[model samples]
Target: MVSFIPSKQLTNPQTVLPEQLVEALAHETPLAFQNVEPFRRKSALADGSQKFLLRNQEGKPVAVAHWASPYAPHSVREAIARVNSAKQAVGASLAPHILGPVGHGNVQGSSFGVFQYQYPLSENKFFWPVQRAQITPHLLQFLQEVARVTQVPVPTSEIETKFAAPLQHLSLMEEVPGEIRTAAAQALCRLERGLWAPRYVLMHGDFWKGNVLLTQKQPPEPKFVLIDWAGSKVQGYAIFDLIRMAASFKVKPKRLGENVAAHCQILGCDIRDAKSYLLAAGGHFALNLGCFPLERFVCMMQASVKDLDKALAATEVN
Candidate 1:
């Protein structure tokens, strides 16, 4: 059981419950132990997901924990247990820290705990669909879940928008380096200008290499796990997950077909339609790039433009 201090909404700086999960930590760790500092919100989730720096009584930060809504039939606690258990057989070395059922159960009713590895100071860019199979079983399970959820066709007009844009635009943050910036700018122009119609599919909205953790479970062979499973909605474009994966180098770009094929195999879908999915993935990748300061996304976008050079050059005006 993860230890947690009681939350007092009426306190000085009220510690409100994260919207997703409403359970509290199992024990009372010192409030000072949690290292609550400048944090990078992992993807994003429905309204109230609270991410915190776990600390001991001495105010020493112990771990980073996120309190979110229960995804599976189990509570956050069960989910974390499952993820940890699987680490022995599946995840290998990389263990993503899942924390909490959070506060008291709200409408959905759950108060479990989950855990994962500590968040690194920096993150990488890029990734693809069904790519985490090699690393973490937890990730592969997530891939399967995506297919199962999206199996029911989504109405063209009504995909829910869960990921929120920055409260304030960041055109001011330092721009990405030149080549990366230009490349990304070009791709954005094409996407915005409709150089190609994106073939959309359901997405793990926050798709990229940064979200994937590679564990050196054994010699030569490594296992991969995708974390930050929030805003993971279905009925979005399929490519959103794919293009980012490919560009991130988490998976081979040339093997986008193989990547989607693996998922199709698991879900029993036709692989012939994957290229269109790749196109759609490109669109999602563009949105992810624009999510932060230009630098986070610019290089990956530039890398993608290089891959599409001939095509971009050929799209001449009639």
Candidate 2:
């Protein structure tokens, strides 16, 4: 029997940054030093990684800074390494320039890591082109290059273990109706069975439109820059990244299959084999939904389940 924990206690508490930390950031970086007010933005994680838009003396946004609560030194290290690796693999023009660590100190009894940041073009109202003709080739190039540097052999056991978390969660969720739970379980089982013969590559674990930044509105060449490397993994399914990216832009599932086909052609994967990867990727999102705070939990959960159902039907996976 799976015992339920209260959702409120399971959620990570929000951490407010001190004026001292903001002042310390200005001193550490090449920004106009002052008691400038920082604008807060919503972060993907609830782990108190506070993202703030720091403005200069003229009140122009200069840089963004992410201050991590609970002091994840390893995460900080990985972020630096991944950013540098990606920069080398792609180029400085297409990757966020990490300005290095800023400051680390205690905030509200929790230790934190203050890190420098980059101003992405997306912040200035830039978005990717909706047309596949313009979007596909550039995205493909970026994904291929990123995979080239970061690919590593991962054990099948590790992949299976990672995929199982969601299934376990769904089995224990009393709130899920019986039919939905049964269908989801069956889909997960099919996915697990299908993924036994796996292919691995380095993945921008959370690859989506939001993390991709465009440098120009009009193009002779549209410069694409990737940001937020903390969630990256060396041995990950490439198809997972592709699926997430398509979903991020609200591409229809049928259209997503077309995108998937193009991705497979570039990476040399059989299109027929993409189903398991898609389902497994959906499972990851579905399982993680409950872990998020209540505000985003239901909406994200519904979207994930919808994606799973679409993929299952599109692929005709029993």
Off by over 4 Å in 1: 1-63, 67-149, 156-201, 214-224, 260-302, 305-318
On residues 1-318, what C-alpha lDDT tens digit does candidate 1 reach at each position?
A: 343344424222655544333223333232223323323455423223445555555665554454444454234444344434433322322323222222222234534332433333133223323334444344434554455444444333422221111101111123434544333344334434544233323455555556665433242544454565444443454534554555444444335444455655544434432333333343344446533445445555445445333222333211
TM-score of 1: 0.41
Clashes of each: 48, 0
TM-score of each: 0.41, 0.62
Candidate 2 wrongly placed segments (more than 4 Å): 1-23, 31-35, 42-46, 70-137, 147-153, 156-160, 163-196, 215-221, 252-255, 265-269, 284-290, 293-318
Best by TM-score: 2
- Candidate 2: clashing pairs of residues: none
Candidate 2 lDDT over residue span 1-318, tens digit each? 111111112122443456555555544555443223343443455444555555555555555655554555345445756656655544454444223345544444444444433433333334434333466566755565555544444466765565555555554555655644564466456546763344566667666655654544555665555667766655555576766666765556665655566555555545544554544454555565545554454344456456645754675542
Estimate the lDDT of model 1.
0.40
lDDT computed for candidate 2: 0.52
